[model samples]
Each structure stands twice: as C-alpha cells, then as structure tokens.
Target chain A: MATLDINRVRKSYGSMEVLKEVNISIEDGEFLVLLGPSGCGKSTLLNIIAGLEDITGGDVLIGNRVVNDLPPKDRDIAMVFQSYALYPTMTVRQNIEFGMKIRGISAEERAKATKAAAEMLQMTGLLDRKPSQLSGGQRQRVAMGRAIVRHPELFLFDEPLSNLDAKLRVDMRTEIKRLHQRLGATIVYVTHDQIEAMTLATKVAVMKDGIVQHFGTPQEVYDRPANTYVARFVGSPAMNILRGRLVASDGPVTVAFETSDGEALVSGVPLSPESAARFRDREVLVGIRPEHFTMDTAGAVPLTVDMVEPTGPDTLVVFSAGGADVVARLDPLAISVGTKARFGVKAEKIVLFDPETETRLD
Target chain B: MATKSLARQRAMGQTFIYGVLALLALYYLTPLWVMITTSLKPLDEIYGGSFIGLPQTVTFEAWSKAWSGACIGTECTGLKPYFINSILMVVPAVLLSTGLGALNGYVLTKWRFRGANLVFGMMLFGCFLPYQAVILPMAQVLGKLGLSGTIPGLILVHTLYGICFTSLFFRNYFITIPDELTKAAQIDGAGFFRIFFSIMLPAALPIIVVSCIWQFTQVWNDFLFGVSFTSGSDSPITVALNNIVNVTTGRKQYNVDMASAMIAAIPTLLVYVTAGRYFVRGLTAGAVKG
Candidate 1:
C-alpha cells in the first residue's frame, strides 16, 4: 500500500478545460472518494490518477514517487470499471489469473493466488463459470477478485456499483468496504452517490465544474461545506440556504428573516467574535440542514407546511421561508399540509454564509 | 363451428406458407439435382435420350474420368492438380486476409489513433471498388514481382482484396465489445497482441467463421481473377473447369463437365453447410451486457 498525491492537476481538451488546477493527497490505506455529478470530471480525475488519461499539467505521485509518465500497468494500479469489465469469455479463475499469466507467473502460483482470491470473495464455486453465466453481483465480485489477485499498491474504482440494482448496490457497497478494510490498499473510488462516499470514504472530495469544492472528512463536508454548491450537493433534501439579516446585540447574535407570518427570529446564532463584530447588522444566508430543524412550540418562526414526504424513518416537511423553499426532517409526527407550525433551528448546527459571495462567513 | 373454422383457417395459412417455401426450395435445388443426376449418367446415355433423367446404367467411370483423365487445353492433366492449386491458394489467402482484417478491425476500433476513421473510411471505400478496375495494375505488380501466373500471386491478390470485407466484418463486430474490457486488460499487464489473442480472438469465433467462409467462397468461386492471372496447368479449379467445358474439337463431355463443376463447388458448399449457422447471430452477440 502507498500514499497517493495529486499536485496541481489540470486536464483540458484544446480550449475546453475539464479539470482545473486540482490538488488532493491521501495517506496510505485511506479511501479517497471523488464525488460529483455527471460531467463534473470526477471520473476524469480518477483516470488521471490511474494513468489512463494524460493530465494537461501536474504530477501524480504514488508512494511519494512521481509517476506522471508511467503507463497504467507500470504505475502498479488495478481498476474496476463501472461495467465490471471481466473478460467475458474467460471463466472466473482465468479472469483472476490473467494478469499473472501476462506477467509470466508460474502456473502453480497463479492457481494458488486465484484460489485464495476466489475464497476471499466467497465465489469459489463460480471459478469455472464465465462472466455471462454470473449474476450482476457475482460479476462484480469477480471483478474485485481480478483486482485482488493483482495485489497492486493502489486500486481504482469507477462507479463500480452503479450498474447493480438498488438492493445489490447496497450489498456490494458493504462488500467493497469490507474488502478495503481487509486488504488495506489505498483506493481512489469515483461515484456520484454521496451516501457511498459518506459510508466508504475516509476523505471525500466534493467536486463541482472541475474544481474541488470541498476536501475533508465526510462529516466535515456534510456538517460544514465550504460553499453553497457543496452545502447543497452533499446532503439529501439538501441544506436550505435562507436569506436573512444578522443582528449582533450585547446579549447574543440572532438572524431574523421573513416567515409566512410577519417575521421570524432564530436567536443564539453561533459565530466567531470577529464575524459577530464584522457582520453585526449585515445581510447573510443562513444554512440549515433538514434534520437540524426541530418542532419547537415556543420558537419565533411560524411556517405553513406545503408538502410532506414520509421516507419510512423520517418525515420531510417542506415550507416556504425567506423567499425560498425549505425542507425540515422531523420525526414521523401526524402533521398535515397547510398547517402553521413553529420550528426552531439548532444553533450549533446553523452555518452562516455571506450573501454576496455565498461562502461560509466563519 | 366458429372455433373449427378458425382452426381450419390457421391450418390453411400454415399450408400456404409451407407450399411457397417448398416451391422456392425446389426451384433453388433443381440445378443441384440435375448436376448430381447427370454426373451419374454415362456420356452416351446423356447424348442419346436421358439428358435430365436417371442413367439407365449408373457408373463411376465419368466421375473417375472427371477426376484424373480429362484433357483441358491440350495439357491432358485433369482438374486434380488445379484443385490442389486452388486449395493452396484459398487456404492461405483466407487465413491471411482474415488475420490481417482482424488486426485491422482491432486497431481501428480499440487501439485507435488520429485519422483512424479516415483510414477505415478508405478501406470501406476499397470494398466497393470493382474487381476489374484493379486487375490491370495488380497484374503489372505481380509481373514486376516475378509472381506472374503463380499460385502465390493469386493468393496475394485475393488476400489484398478480401481484407476490405473481412476488416469491415471484424470492425463492426469488435465495436460491440465494450472498450472497458481492453482497458482492464491493459491494466492487467497484457500488451497489444496479448489482449488480441486472449480477449479479442476468443470472442471473435463467430466473426472468424464468417470471414473465413466469405473469403473462401469468394476466392474459391472466382473465375475472372483465376483465368486472367494464371494459364494452363497453373490455373485454379474454376479456370480448369472452364477449359474442360469449352472444348472446340469433340462432342462436349456433359457428364465430365457436370462432375468437374460439382467438384469445384463442393468446398464452398461444405463451408456453408458447416459454418452458416453462425453467420447471422454471431455478429451481434457476446461481450457487453451481462
């Protein structure tokens, strides 16, 4: 296992730049997830790390050695494509042993390695079956088996679970996590699914428009996104950014905004002393996660429930506030639409952004 | 009564379809039937009264004479040596063209470079070029290379021509295979030819059969190239059969001619009979979805 570092990486096609100067580094055995929507160049970054695509400018160092000019095989990386990419005609054993065969490994050693990989993947019975004969999950296991047999220093996964059904995707996600812990190999996994990133990654790089919007631990990215783009992209039902005026008085700081009723005030707003002094009475965007809004009877804000969605575990209540729609995840309470309810924001969880720049204020 | 009439109508539709298919099959098989029957007949029987009928005395004499004794343009050598020549020419030609075409298809689709489409477009344009257009220049090239009237020259000409179709077949076939497979192979340390042999060629069984059968039929049944490029004893079986049939001196040996035609046609017939099942289905199946 080896640490991977990408320094000032940029990719372009003539005049069209896909990846702007992006830098990210991960320690050995840390799972780094490049998360973004389609065309956001997350997969391009993964391919750049794999040496499958050339970078316009930068260095990708594996084990602290610059490997920018090495071929994919020479870089000691194994990739699991989104399609699994198992050799269709070969059986599971042959697919696992193919790399060793190409490298001229001895037959007995290849077979032993194949057997160990198949056993680890719990697919020993499928060793003789071709890829077409295997189910989607089995094919994914075989792909993993192929990569495991290579024993490369780094593993690359390009949305490997995207092709599976929802239930299979969940199972394979856990399976991949288990494999990562067991193998302890450095991995760069690319996915658009934020939950996969949240569950599987030690470090998450939320990308937008070829730029790294946020690069930190998943909780850090989730609880404290760097900007509005990441604030909305990393969460389900998304964080609601409501326009409001910040008021810093002698007692405490509070944000007041227009509610369905006259005006609503969220007091005890958390901010640094410098931010409190600088933005004492300035316009700001208040960011509140869905789960951070609680049903408080004595809260100052009154919101009319516009829509309700019950996702079995929690209820999502949509309301209009500060001239934008807001979603609040509440307990499965028997709340009806069009009802005026008072909700309070958790002070510690609230993030304030500068209204002009849409960046975090503190 | 309604159900009975419906059943009867369905039976009638089936009968009509079978009737038309049977008539078409018989229409196509008539020449083959006549060839088999006339080849079994003695020359005297064919000349006298039983031109299209079963021979009064079926004999192997005509078949044996057609095999080893018939004269063609005063060489008096039978179609045997020419049949061997055609075999020598067709096998290598089919193999080489198919191999080259497979390589071309792999490169055009997988290991692509700049101007790949232009190169493939030029090859596709070569597919529609008339055979007569290239014969003069090809003959000149053959003469310049000291391969004029040789079996190897014919092999070279057929191989060069066959690459267009074979590459077309293989490129279309290989394109259906996902690019991820080769990329995965590359990461697995397999080089260019390693991926071709291990991944591509194995998946290419159906297309290989298709290319071989097509090239074999085209090269085997070609009369113009065989006749124009070679003469006398060095000719392929088609030219030798033409020599056997177009005699200017004596009565036409219709039985020997029929037997020689059947002999020359048997290889392609066997090729089709054995490999035709894969022709339609093989091109569209394998290597992508599941």
Candidate 2:
C-alpha cells in the first residue's frame, strides 16, 4: 500500500492562494521531497500531509485512510521542524519520551523507547541535559530522537537542516539519509536546496508559484525536464538558454541562431511534425545544460570567454552567445579568462521550448 | 606611548561616568533613606530638626503604630487587614493574569487566526486609556453582580486590566521565538495546549517572572481601583496609606505616613532586589528580534 497520498490538495488564505491542486503519493518506504524556492508552498504542502494545516479543497490519505479532518496527534505522523523545536524546559530524555507519555504508554515501555532512541542518535550521555545546554547539532539529534521514538506511520521534515551552519548542514544531510536507509520509513521532506533534493530524494516534486511544475525521479527531472522553468531551476549555475528559430522542418530538424560574432546551427531531437510545422522560421528557446558544452576544433559556435572561475573540480566559464549570456562548465585546466574559444553543443543534450508557452517541444 | 595615553584618557572618562551614576543612584535612594531614618526617630526629634539627618535616638514607636494601632476612620485596624487584602488580591491577580496572558500570547503568536491582529490591536489600545475612565463602568457592572465590595471583585478588575499589558508583553516575547519550535512540537503530536504548556511556557520563564513582578506591584500598590471598588476594612494598604496621609482632621503624622508607605512598598521592593536581573533580562529578551 502507498504509505501516504496527497490528492489534489489546495490551500488558500482568504483570496490569496498559496497551494493549488497539489498531488503526490509516496510508496511504502520512499523518501519524497517537495523542492521549491521560498514562498512556493513546499512547507505548506508538507504541513498539509502532517495534518498541521487544513487542506482547503482536497483530502490526504495515510495508509489507505483519508485523514482530512484528523488533527496532527491522530495523523500517526512525526515531523522534524527547521528549528529543532526541542522542548526547552524538558531534558533531552523527556523530550524523546513526551509523545509516548502523552499516549499513556507504560513507564517501562517509554523508558525503553527513550533509551533506544537516545542510543540510536548517540545522545545517551546528554539525555539529562536541557535543550539550552546542548549544541545546535545535538539539539537537532534530540529532535530526530523525539520523532523516532514514536515510530509513526510517516515522517515529515520541513527544511530541518536550513538552520544549521554549512558544515553541519552537510553532515546532517548524510545522517538523515543514513537514518532513512536504516529505518526504511516513509518520509515526505521539503527543502529549497536543489542539492539536498538531488542527493537525498528518491523522487522530487519541483514547485513554482504554488504549482507543481514537474514530479519525477531526480534523474528524470534533471535529465528530462518537462519545461523551461524546471530545466533552469533544477541545476546549479543554471542551464544556459539561447533564443533561436527553427530553420528546417523535416525528418531531422535543425535550429539556427546568430551570436554577436557569428551564426551557428544545433541539430537535436525533431519536434512533433505539427509543432515543427508551426515553428518553421519562428522563435524558440534552446536550453543546454552547462556541462554539455565542450571545446573542440570542429565546434558549432565561436565565442570570446568573458571570465573563467576555477574551483577544484571544474571550471565555470562565462561567455556571450546568441545575444544571451551563457555559462559553461569545462575542465578546470582547459579554460582561461579573456580567451577566444569555440565550443560545441552536444546535439542530443539540447532541449527546445516554445517561446510563448515555455513548455518542452520534444 | 601616545596610544597608552589615549587608553588612559578613555579609562578616566569611564571612571567619571561611573562617579556620575553613583551620585544619581544616591539621589534616587534619598527619599527611602530619609523615610527609614524618620521611621526610627522619636516623634519629638522628628519634629525638632533636620529632615535628612540621622535620628538622635532610634525608636520603634512609629513602626509599632503603623503596624497595629493606627486608625482608619473609626477602626484601629492599622495596616494589617489592608496589607493582607492587598496580598490576597495581588497574588491571585498576578498569577491568573500572567498565566492567561502567556496563553493568549502563545496562541496569537503560534496559532494565528483570522482577525487576530485586529483583536490584538484593540487590546493594545485598551492598555493606553486611563484606568479611571473605565472604573465607573466597571464598578456599576460589578455592583450589579453583587461583587462590588469583595476581594474577588478587585482581583477580577486587576486581572482584566492587567491582561492587556501582560498579554502584550508575552505575545511580543513569544514572537521572538522561532515558529519552527512550535511547529516541531506540533509534529511531535503536541496539541495546542500541550505545545503551549510544554514547549512555549517553559521557554517563557524569564518573561513570566517579569510579568508576575510587574502585575504584583501594580495591583499591590494600586490606590484608585482599591478605593473605588472596595470599601470598609477590605481596602488594600495603598488606600489605608492614602487615608492616613490625606485625612485633614488628624494631626499630620508624616513619620507614620512615610513608614506606612515604605511598608506598603516592601513586597515590590523585595521582588526587585531578588529578581531584578531577570526583570531586565526578560524585558530586553522579549524585545530581541529572533
């Protein structure tokens, strides 16, 4: 059975709509991430699933039961909030045992669960200390322990790592992934970090302006983006988009555009005949991932490099092409600033979108 | 060497500032010192000379009279019943008002509802109006309910007036706590009351101490409401102190009046001495952004 299902959930505050027709289903043990920028309602969607937020127009089902009217306590779900939210007055042990205590569990059972959870999170020695006395990362682990002791049907994380420092955030990211693997628990996580979505999510739902742009496996969303927005939003250093026109309409289609220095052609997957017929000699947006560009003797476009930024592993080169600014990631040693270069676009990696609609044209 | 002289100049400037602060502290404490000296002086010495000088001979007569023998109208009630009544009224008033106010603050900050801001704005405006303007109406309502002369009635009035300020204090303090804390509690299966009592309330200790001390002093030293709502021997110490000081027919016993006023202020003064650090910390902590 699917562990959790959110069907056509919509949320609005008065006339201001925050989430619209959002839908997702998590298989029994999958880690699904709702990935979006701030104010895109990813947290709102997670709250809806946790029953902390009331859905305005649809139902949420957990383990085959619709939970639209249920309160958070009855939802059988545990959540870890961005702030850690450890009970400030309680000791770490009490914080972990609070849920079981409220549920009227036996003292022995509560002790067992608290001990096990503390041991699992490596917080046993700190169990008697108040949250104020613990470090930020330690408090975060207690928060996780608090949720783990419940062993709820589903786990919800609402940007739980956003508050940590950079190094701690990376460490917690790996810790959470390990926890997921160990528990095999159903989790619905929300984050604005695309890197986190890429690294941790089994499936990623990219949201924009309160609508899900695309929902698929991370590789699918990255490799086969459904629209121009998804293509630009899912990757770091962003995909380079160039304005072009379809020059030929045949079994094998081609697009042509003019840079400041020269004109170039890139051939790729043919559009549908109808779409190709309509776009003949019409404007289209061609998107190419930065990593797909390569320096070759027989290159498709000639350009002057404006700048080259070399990090340890890769070089990011900024250059002008097709009357647009484009960035390409190349081998760190191969590129230099203020150099004239010719780079080829991998034709199979090129994506085309309708200029007006911005939807993929493949 | 020039830098060392500049540092020396800064140190001298700081010393000058501390000297001025010490003088200001003495100036503020002058009246209390004078009252204590006068309270211990014999009436003859008090009437004979220097108002700010040490007493020629210390005596406990004034304290004794202020505690047990002083007359309030026809009764020789001194300040005992009034002091007890003030304690009774202020204790429950502070406890209830601060407790309920914290709850109100927790709800408004965490579980915001439609028109919540409007409700808060109205309550804030209510705090600014002079308390006298509402006393007559409050008195009439209480009189109709047969609570005009009761301690509970005074408590209810004090708590009602205190809620606006106390809730404002706590709500503003709670807004500084990250909403993520409450959200985390909610996800841990904590209901509204649970999250409030377990998570928010515990984090709110400093503010609660502050609100309690503030409300206690306000209600304890209150004269207007105590005089208006309460009558007979059920009056608070402030009302008794006022009557003793302001009644014109009796010989003006300034010594006794000062002692009684000081006595009436002891509770709040003791609270300040004990938890003054928490008071400043709580107020500033609430004002901090996140």
Candidate 3:
C-alpha cells in the first residue's frame, strides 16, 4: 500500500484550462473518490495520479517518491476501466496472467496467482472462455481479476461499474468494497454517481468547473457543504435554496421573508457580529435539504403541493415555498397533490449564504 | 380472402429479390467461366470454335506449353522464371507491408500524439493518387540506390503502394475499439509496446487476415510496376503473359495465352477461397455498431 499526494495539480489543453491548482492527499489504504458531473475534471485528476496524463504544473508523490515524471508501469498502480478492457484474443486465464508475464514473474508464480485470482472472483469455470463469449457482468469480474492478480501498490477504478445494469452495479460495488477491505490497498476511484461516491468512499472530493468545491467525509460534505455549489451538487433531489432577507440583528438573528399570505420569520441561526452588522436588513439565500422539512400542524410556512410521487418507501412532495420549488421527503401517506401542507424547517438544518458570493454565512 | 392475396404478393416480392441476386452473380462469373473454357480447348478448336461452346477435345497441351515449352523471344523457358520472381516479390511485400501497416495503425489509434491525424490524412491521400503518376520518380530513386530491375526494387514498390491501403484498413478497424480498453491497460502498468502487443494486436486478427489478402492480390496481379521496373525473364508472370498474347506479326497462341492468364490468377483465387469469409467480415466489421 502507498500514500498518494497530489500537490497543486493543474492541467490545460493549449489555452483552455481543464484543472486549476487541484490538491488532494490520500493516506495509505484509504478509499478516495473524486466525484462530479461530466467534464468536471475528476477523471483528469485520476489520470494524472496514474501517470496516464501529464500535469501542467504540480507534483505527485507516491510513497515518498515523486512520480510526476514516471511512466504508468513504473508507478505500480492497477486500474479497472469502465469498459473492462480484457484482451479479446486471450482466454480469461491468459488475460489475468498478462501483467505478471510482462513483469517477468516466474511461470509457476504466474500460474499460482492466476488460479488464486480466478478462485477469489469465483471464475474457475470461466478460465478457458474468451472475453467475447462472456456476458458483460462476467467480463467485469474478469477485468477485476486481471487487476488484482498484479497486486500493485495502488488500485485505480474509472467508473468501473458504469457499464453494468443497476442490480449488477450494486453487486459489483459491494464486491469491490469487500476486495478493498481484504486487500487493504489504497484506491483512487472516479465516478459521477453521487450514491457510489457516498457509499464507497472513505473521503469524497466534490468538484465543479475544474475546481474542488469541497473535500470531506460523505456525511461532512452532505451536512456542512462549504458553498452553495457544494450544497447543491452533493445531494439527490438537490437542496432547496430560498431568497430571503435578514430583518433583525442580535445574538440570535432572525431572517424574514414575505410569503404570499404574510411575512414569516426563521430564527435560531447564529451569525458573526460583524456579518450581522453588515447584513442587518440585507437579502441572503437560505438552503434546506428535503429531509429537513417536517410535517407539523403549527409549521411557519404553508405550501400548496404541486405534485406528489410515491417511491415505495418514501413519498416525494413537490410544493411551492417562498415562490420557489421546494421538495420534501415525507411519509408515503402524508400528502397528495393540490393539498395545502404545512412544513417546519429545523433551526440546525437551515443554512445561510450570501446571495452574491454564494458562500456560507453561518 | 384478401389476406391470401397479400401473402402471395409477399412471396412474389421475395422471389424477385433472389432473381436479381442470381443475375448479379452470373454477371460476375461469366468472364472467369469463358477464360477457363478457352484454356481447356485445343489450339485449332480455340481458333475455329464458337466462344461459348463446349470444347470438342479437352487437352493438357496448352497447360504444359504455358508451364515450360512456349517461346518468349528466342528462349523457350516459358513462364517459370516470371512465376518465381512474382512469388518472391509478392510474399515479402505482403508480409512486410501488412505487418508495418498494422503496427502503424496500432500506434495511431492507441498512442495518439500531436499531428497524428495529419499523418493519417497524408497516408489516406497517398492511396488516392494514381500509381502511374509516381512510378517514374520512384523508379529513378530505386535506380540511384542500385535497386532498379531487381526483385528488391519490385518489393519496395509493392510495400509503398500497399501501405496506404493496408494502414487504412487496419486504422478503420482499430478505431472501433473503445479507448477505455487502452486506458485500462495503461493503469495496469503497461507501457506503449506492451499494451500494443499484448492487448491491441491479438484482437486484430480478422483485419490482419484482410490486409494480408488485399496486399497479396495487389502485389501478385500488379502489371504496371512489374513491367516498368524489371525487364527480360526477371519480370513477373503478368509481363510474360502480356508479351505472349500481344506479340504483333506472330501467330497468337490463344490457348497458351489463356492458360497462362489462368495460371497468373491462381494465387489470388486461392487467397479468396481460403480467407473469403474473414475478408467480408473485416470489411463489414467497421459497420458493426460497438
């Protein structure tokens, strides 16, 4: 196992900058996931670490040695690609043994490793089959088997489960987690799926527009996003943002906004005295998660449901609040469309942000 | 019922399609059948018989004369030396050009560098130019290097011409391979050469067979380059066949000429029969959606 340190890595193609001064450090045996939307440079960062792409300016350290100038083979990293890249001409056994054979491992040792990998992946019967003859899920297992047989210092996975069906993706995700635990290898995984990032990563780096917006544990990033972009990008059914203004300044500030019916006050948000003095009666954005809203009879805000979708376990209610669309995850039997529903926002779950800068205020 | 008429109409349409296909097949095979029939007839029968009639007597005399006894100039060495020379040129030319073309394709598709597409475009343009336009300059260069009129000169010409098409064939096939495969190999600690040989080359068997067949036929049947480059008995069999049939003021040995033409075409016919399925598969594999 090895610790990977990415120090201020930047990438550009001619004049268009793709990655800007990105920095990430992973400890030994840590599962680090770089998650973002397409064209967000998450894959670029992973490629840089693997030495497949050269960084415009920065250094990558693998186990105390700078690997910025080293080739991918010399970096001692194994990668599983989204396409499963098995040698089509070779049988499953030969595909797994190729890396060992190239590295000049003895024939006996190559055979042993191939057998053990096949057994571990439960692919003993598939040893003689070619990749074209294998089903997609079986080919994926063979791709994983090929990587693990090498037993390299670090493992790289580039959306390796993106090609599988939903059920198979879930199964392979669990298999990958178990393999990581058993091997205790450092892994840098890239995926655009937020659920995969949350479930598989020890640390998640959420990115946007070629910059790291926030890097933390999944819970930390979900609960305490650094900015509005991070807040909006990390969650499904994304966080709701409300336009409002601060109406009072004190130890416990009150932010008030005018509903169609009347004015409503949201309390218990602690603000710095200096920020409070500047935004005494100024407008700011308030962010709220879907699950943070509760069904209370004495709720401060009354919203008319525009749509209701029941997803078996939970009901998603889409309603208009503060003249903006707000989604709430409620009990399946809670409400229906065109009904007047009252929801109370918790003090701790409410987030305050500057409307212009989009940074968190409190 | 009207449904019975609709079924009969569909059956009629299907038969029309098969009829058209059979007509096209006959159109393609007619000349080859005529040549075979002409070669089997005796010399007097060839001169006096109807072009499409069955021969009165089937004889091996024409075949024997074409193989060893027919006169080309004062020498009666027939077409043996020309056949030997053609084989010498075609085998090495096909092997070298296809091997290099495949390597070039592997590099261009997987190991992309700056100006890679420009180089590929240049190669494509090379295939478009008429061979006659470049033959003189090529022959001059070969003569200066002491390669003109030799088997090596013909081999060099064949390799050059074959590369443009062979590389094109391999490149188009390789482009269908997903980039994720190469990226995955890179992450598995494979260098450029390792990834190419171990991964890309093995998956390219169908296209390689296609390239070999293409280059073999092209070099084997080439008349212009062979005639322009070498003279005397050192020329390929096509040149000898042309000299035999086109001789003015001499009695045309129609039987011997037809027999020699058939002999000259055998290598390509054998190639087509052996790797025909792979050739069609390779050509159409590009159209198969990944």
Of 2 and 3, the candidate ahead on TM-score is: 3
- lDDT per residue (tens digit) for residues A241-334 in model 2: 8898888768557888776568778776557788888888899988889999887758887788888888779988888877678988888766
lDDT of each: 0.91, 0.86, 0.86
- Candidate 3 clashes between residue pairs 3 or more apart in a chain or in different chains: none
Q: Show where candidate 2 strays beyond 4 Å.
A: A249-252, A268-274, A277-281, A335-339, B1-24, B246-254
Where in model 1 is the C-alpha error above 4 Å? A248-252, A272-282, B286-290
Docking verdict class for candidate 3: medium
What candidate 2 keeps of the native contacts, as a fraction, is: 0.76
Superior candidate under lDDT, 2 versus 3: 2
lDDT tens per residue, model 3, B34-73: 7888888887887785667777899888888988877777
Clashing residue pairs, candidate 2? Answer: none
Top-scoring candidate (TM-score): 1
The regions of model 3 sitting more than 4 angstroms off are B1-28, B248-250
Going through the candidates in order, their DockQ values are 0.77, 0.65, 0.71
Q: Candidate 1: which pairs clash?
A: none
lDDT of 2 by residue, B159-266 (tens): 999999999999999998888777666666678888888888888989998999899888988889999988888888899888877773545776787788888989
